[model samples]
Target: MSASVTPGEPGIFERMFPIRERGSTVRTEVLGGVATFLTMSYILVVNPAILSQAGLPFGAVVVATALAAAVATAAMGLLSTYPFALASGLGINAVVAFDIILGRQVPWEVGMACVVIEGLIAVALVLAGLREAVVRAVPTSMKLAIGVGIGLFICFVGLRDGGIVVNNPATGVGLGDLTAGPPLIALAGIFVATAMTVRGIRGSILAGIATSTVLGLVFGVLDGPDAVADWPGSDQFSTIGDALDPDNLADALTWALVPVIFALFMTDFFDTIGTAVSLGRAGKLDDAQGELPEMRRVLLVDSGAAVLGGAAGASSVTTYVESGAGVSEGARTGLASLVTAGLFLLAIPFVPLITVIGQSVPYVGDTTVVPAIAPALVMVGFLMTRLVQAIDWGDVQDAVPAFLIIAGIPLTFSIAAGIGLGVLGHVVAMTAAGRARQVHPIMWVLVPMFLAFFAEDWLSVNVF
Candidate 1:
């Protein structure tokens, strides 16, 4: 028998998928779900693309990764009771595919193993109560800066992915030639998506994606039945064994497994923690005491998802704060996420659906499409709010740390390093101004360690 809800005493499912409260109607929930899903749908394509580049069978990789994400995300909604969703992280994928796999030529199986180990570390940290302590240790300004910095970084990623930003050695970053093909159609779709979203239209992102996809089809920018006919299927479970091959065990153990494990641990550790705190503040998910509760649950689920993702043949898993955009639109409980998860679960059978859609879209040409537009516009929105929220606009002391953190992420291509440097900078500035007592004592230990680590990296590069 199906579960039932008691009158006025919402059952677990009811509580999870609560009906609309003030300022949020049934329509709002539906719209929020679409936004959340579209924003995350990139994983369906990107994950397969990356894993395929790493020499995994495209079909098996896509199916397994999607299934893992579905399970992990459903667990987050059911277990954590937060609206947050999980997927293969953006920057970490670049690090995995580029820095670890391709750069070091580590076997893909070993790469998966590293992801598994990192997940274990994350789980242990959350269980040990260190997640909260570590988050609290970060300065408020630093936290806010991290949020904005990540947003900017994500925007940059979207731009690059959509082909809005093309490299030109002669003139640095410039627009790609619109005549170049799929990128043009993708660009067009971005503007349309942006226009719909700006007017507060429901499913603006979805509309934009659909519109671009259709244009691509009409213009021959995308493939038709041939792409589907050639598409891979999920028949290669043995690849998982190859990924864990004993023959490649030693190289995997030393380079691929070890470095990636450390990289994922440190990177996702800070990324998830910072995102939770920031999104908690944004969604007002704090408890009666205004502290974030159930945080361990969020971290545990995120970390657990990584392990599951690795085993299932994907990269690292982390929470997407873009889901907060849905929350800002009024998603109070986990139901929104459950609904989002349901859609992803359905999309698995439609892998050809994604490839077809990707192919059918028309290039945006000179006009930017909606999806591309939304993030840039959202970045503007965040910047304006941040400027108004600044505690002391005139003080260089406050401005310096914020600037360093914001600029450091893309500059170093490491969010953790950016935050670490920002924290150390803040502590130093405070201490030099005779405000050392105002700083937390833990700062003394952490700042020195951060400096020492970076110093070691520099020494290794320069001297060795």
Candidate 2:
């Protein structure tokens, strides 16, 4: 079918092909498509890098993970009827790759097993009706904090992925050397792309990536036999089993595997829920009960993706809030995901092209770029930007909770922890001022849970 025909209402094709619907005719679609493409282009190169770091073959992780994300995301749109796209989650990848794989030193197979287990847990939670209850248990302010925090976190991740930020021993953390090599070239490309995006250039993100990649090659940032391999060819179907040996499997299961399984499930569940709630607000997909239905579908798709990601030899799968960037560009249905999937599938033939691009990009140099902290920083900035609407600057009691909520996220590196602390601070402030009656009973329940969560983490660290 062609575009939907109702006036002011987008057509089916428009709904299906979200990027194309931003404006009325082909021109609008092209603009939206470019924007959509730019926003997502990073995944094409970044996902493979992250997954390969976790010990999967680059070829297998890229092709299989992309295909798995496509299938699960399409199912989300087709079944739940939401306009969300799914991909290997942002934070969860680090957790899987670093904590599970490197820290625990688990085999990729065991990491995949953990993903599958986590996915099953998520599915079970949704079926048990815990999804809504858990979300409701969180306060509105806290939820908003999480949303903004994660957004900033994602942006930070993008900067890192683009090689704009690197660690420094002398300054603790500072800008990379931009003038020395590919990092400089990459930074230049990002700036150009960002400028183009600001100037309303469609596909600025894609352009930035492409420009940086080309510059990387020209500057000798990436060169080797691996760099020149053909795109799709027979290499694309390589699997996890290729790198995994039978001898390592037994040892990996005994030590590394168990911890990874636990970490992946717990981290993905919390991260998925947080991102879902956050992005749902951005998309404005509130349920009849005033909650975001997208949150529920997020749980489902994320969980399913985790399971499939395991089979496909990737880490824990979760929803991509980056999709919200696409939504902001006017994607309102699964069609956006289908398009994303289609793009991934098509890229198979150009695998070498993407590899080259990844190698060519440069890292960001200098502290001016901002610390590689979580998205909480951006969320705080966003909240402060609208502080007048959400809170009164004159009231210390009301403002303290918000302050703690914002500061606590990055300070602790846990959004839920920050929220929990904020709630406790709110409760204490109200009680001390003789306003204890104003506190909701439901809020009381969270205090204990928060305490337990922290206590567990503490005990694990101390004892284990």
Candidate 3:
């Protein structure tokens, strides 16, 4: 039934992952993988909720998100032999929803096509060995600012989605009724999750989502699922392969959209590098220079993940900082990633449960559908803001761009625009401070491109 091996020879798993060489065993890797999955599993509900707003089917997105995550994460493990997991990224999903689809008035398919295009471009960059050049081109302050800005943007969106924030005709934004069911539940969830996070609990965000869902059910604000379980079929994958459709691809490939694609690429680019480096250091997997071994392989997998995610109708998938949870639990090899990937696939049958947790509760009017996942979003934003300390705030040249990014994101409701503003701010601040030589030449090229991006509509009407 099986091929015989020499008595002292390493088994298949051992040879493939070299678990013992990494100072770990199979049991440790599995446990670490479980810990990692539990911490980030909130994305199952949250990603669907965010993408559904852009007209993606909630159930279909749930399936796509899980499958895409499984495939991407598994590829990362097999190819790079690193204990990192990939999933539909938070800020990028927001871009797909609010910016490309809603703000630009494009169809969901077109937005996703843009994601695919960005991914392909990233793959080309990695293959051409230009990824590092691009990475070094952006100032570290600006890089940190992008994450911080996105955190604020996500937090703002969470507040609005949870009914904790509402639009005001006079002031443009105002607080919502905390006494209402949705906002009340959101507040309770925030308290619980924040407390758990402070206590060093694993899966704190998932816990918060569960608590909010329970509260929503108790208050009759959310409806129970009609079915407890169901088999996943082809029809449930409504959005799959839409990104590769000819018409959608054509629509996404246009000169007017170059800046948008660049924005997506930049976000995806920096996020992977920063996350990989941090995870590597946390796991003690980095070399003397604080760089990950086989980093090019890792980047390749991550870049390919974006293409896979978009083709599957998920947003751009990338390395998760939550992989640190696994690292803390002694996950130092690809085995842990394999375990996480398996868990994601195993979760496919539980689509109904995911939908129940992500289901919208119409709160104030037909326009507002409050989600239970808001607390997690708020917590994620809080985590990202921690990066603010790493920025050189004392230097005005550094502070200006970072400040603009932090303020621009939530204010403009567009991550791409916030990044654009930050880049422009960086150039202006450096030039004004007589430090213009420090500006990367690539940044100069981006200045006019972003300017054109901001004025695309006007240019289309008057010049283009």
Cα deviation at 441, candidate 3, in Å, is: 1.6
Best by lDDT: 3
How does model 3 fare in lDDT? Answer: 0.89
Identify the runs in model 1 with alpha carbons over 4 angstroms from their true place.
Answer: 1-39, 46-61, 81-84, 98-114, 225-232, 235-286, 291-293, 322-339, 356-395, 412-424, 427-431, 434-464
lDDT of 2 by residue, 62-118 (tens): 677667666776776666555566667655665566555665556666556556666
Best-fitting candidate, measured by TM-score? 3
- lDDT of the structure predicted as candidate 1: 0.63
- What order do candidates take by TM-score, descending? 3, 1, 2
> Of the pair 1 and 3, which is ahead by lDDT?
3
RMSD of 2: 7.4
User: CA shift at 347, candidate 3, in angstroms?
Assistant: 0.8
Which segments of model 3 are wrong by more than 4 Å? 1-9
Ranking by lDDT: 3, 1, 2
The per-model lDDT (C-alpha) reads: 0.63, 0.57, 0.89
1-464: candidate 3 lDDT, tens digit per residue? 89887786876777899688889877898999998999888888899999998889989999999999999999998999889999999989988899899988899999999999999999999999998789889888988998899889999989988999998889999988888888988888888999999998777888888889999888887888877778888877988899999999999987667777887898899999989999999988999988899999999999999999999999999999999999999998898999999999999889988888888877766666655989889999898888899999898888999899889878999877888899999999989989899899999999998898889989999997
Candidate 1, residues 352-404, lDDT tens digits: the string is 66545432233444442222222332333243235325435466666677778
The clash tally of candidate 1 reads 29
Better of 2 and 3 by TM-score: 3
| lDDT over C-alpha atoms for residue 458 of model 2 | 71
